[model samples]
Target chain A: MTDTEPRKESVSCPMDFILRMLMGPWTTYILYNLKTHGPQRFGELKRRVAGISAKMLTERLRTLEGAGLLRRDYEATIPPKVTYSLTKRGHELDGVLGSLAEVGARWEAEDAAARSQRAAESKSAELRAAE
Target chain B: MTDTEPRKESVSCPMDFILRMLMGPWTTYILYNLKTHGPQRFGELKRRVAGISAKMLTERLRTLEGAGLLRRDYEATIPPKVTYSLTKRGHELDGVLGSLAEVGARWEAEDAAARSQRAAESKSAELRAAE
Candidate 1:
């Protein structure tokens, strides 16, 4: 929809809907991990995500599944194996994820460089004060 | 950095860094609004964003400014005009935002279609029961 269209105060606006989908904590990260590493078991995903509580992971997974973004496969094996992977629809986020990564890398590097420069400047100022 | 590279437990990872930047509430919305509408004074922006409180808008605007993603221009006058626009760094998010909008619009349309079909199916089932 064009911007000229009267903006709705609800998620009916395309941008608003997508933002709500992706805005949850650890949502995009979960998608990225699955996309990059392929299907993963619950434990494996939790480890890969790092710092995500088991409960949070389960909740996010269910949300994604409910939205039809990912698939959950079940196996009635010895330990009852279950795996999560991006569905065809979830994979559709490849471009958006890629862009985020590329831009993130670039910005992160720039921020680091700026930090280093600031540190060096402060150190020199300290030296000048001592003299 | 390649995913094969060992992941850090911090925002050093490219995806993590960018996600942290964008994951805040109403952040992308604010950026999207600025990009589409060009420079806008604070009052106009508060209106266009829809449902954003003046306090939240001010906070998000400050955060964006702090990150160097947007510029705030001030005109010293009776009303104290202040305009906000995306900086070069913020403009870099154009591709990311565009992808989200496209994906969101497509999904929204699909969702609408699915809802309609479900309604039709339920109606048919009800008619069958009546017969």
Candidate 2:
């Protein structure tokens, strides 16, 4: 639907809905990890997404599952193994993720350049003051 | 830099940086509005981005400005008008935003279809119970 459409009965704006789906702290990271590394167990995901607490990881996983982005598979085994993989819908985000990564890389480069410029300016200022 | 690069002095990951820039409430909305409607005054933006508090709007604007995504113009007028517009970098996000909107539209359609199916199922269950 276009942005101008009347939404008197809609639950939420499409933009808002997608943003909500993606706004969770570790949501994108978790999705990225799953997409890149394929299906992984809970513990493996936890390790791959560094600095994420177990509580946060579990919550984000449930959110992603609820949103139909990923599937949880239960394997009958001696230890009861569980794996997570992106569903078809989840894999649909590949394009967006790739774009985001490219943008992120450009931003990183710009930031690095800015930082170096500022450092050089400061160094020159100090040298001029000493002279 | 590639993901495999070992950075001994990096400030943050590129993914983390872009995510941080986009994660703030009303950020993407404001950007989308500006991109679609062209430059807008502060008050106009505040109104267009519904539900955003003045304080929050100000914070997001500053963040966007700091990140070089948008530019703020101060026009010396009777009341000192300030306008915000997307910078070249901000405009670079058009492709990403377009993709997001498309994905969001698809998600909304899927959600609506699911709701209808559930409603139909519940109605059938009710009819069966009545019989």
Candidate 3:
């Protein structure tokens, strides 16, 4: 039982590896942006993924590229332009991200409801204490 | 626009923070086990979550407890026994986790199909090169 937790060194189970790759803070946002908006340059991706930093976005892009999930194209010019888009392999993950997005929406609703309930309960508790 | 990234300090968007909370490698597994198996002891949790070690499991449990996602009940006995289960807030996350699990299954199937397709294409290319 090698249960002591291994490093993220090339996950052996293919699907697990793939899922973990997209498990980053900005991963789903980035992937969804690519799927919905098509190919985008580096700064375009940064803008679309909400809270991603330049360094983190760059690191994430490199990881995705290394894992064969995305393809990068560079155009030669005075200032080089780099564009990234999903590869065939990455496109396969869209269905997965789609499913997650649906769940995320539900969680948003439920969490809101829970917070309201708590607020109500808190107010009642305060009234009782005052009485 | 605060273009610079902030640390994961106190996630502002409740959903974003919560999602990030459950985004750890072994998180879903731990929660799923709790949902399916009901409240269990520390050792049981350790066994159920495939790759979690004692130290990491302790850390995660403490984090979840601190976040109000789980409740810890300690039975005062000859030896200590600690049991953990989901809070109402954590139960609310079930819908989200369920959605993710469905997507995870889809990704598994798609990865298999894609690998087969690639293997076939590679063989075809090899044969063409030989010719």
Provide backbone clash counts, one per model.
0, 0, 0
Candidate that beats the other on TM-score, 2 or 3, i.e. the better one: 2
Candidate 2 chain A: minimum summed lDDT over ten consecutive residues — where? A4-13
**Alpha carbon lDDT of residue A5, candidate 1?**
35
For B1-131, candidate 3 gives per-residue lDDT tens digits of: 17634653332233344556676776666777788889989999997775678999988888888877889999999799999999886786666556455555666677699999999999999999999
- How large is the C-alpha RMSD of every model relative to the true structure? 5.9, 5.8, 5.7
Residue-level lDDT of model 1, residues B1-131, one tens digit each, is: 47753544562346665666676677877887788789999999988888789999999999889988999999999979999999999999888878888998898889999999999999999999999
Clashing pairs in model 3, backbone N/Cα/C closer than 3 A: none
Better of 2 and 3 by DockQ: 2
DockQ leaderboard ranking = 1, 2, 3
- What DockQ does each prediction reach against the true complex? 0.44, 0.39, 0.22
Q: List the residue pairs that clash in candidate 1.
A: none
Candidate 1 regions with alpha-carbon error over 4 angstroms:
A1-12, A116-131, B1-8
- Candidate 2 lDDT tens digits, A54-104: 999988988899989999998899888889999998999888878887998
| DockQ, prediction 1 | 0.44
Q: Candidate 2 — which residues are off by over 4 angstroms?
A: A1-13, A76-78, A114-131, B1-13, B125-131
The CAPRI classification for model 1 reads as: acceptable
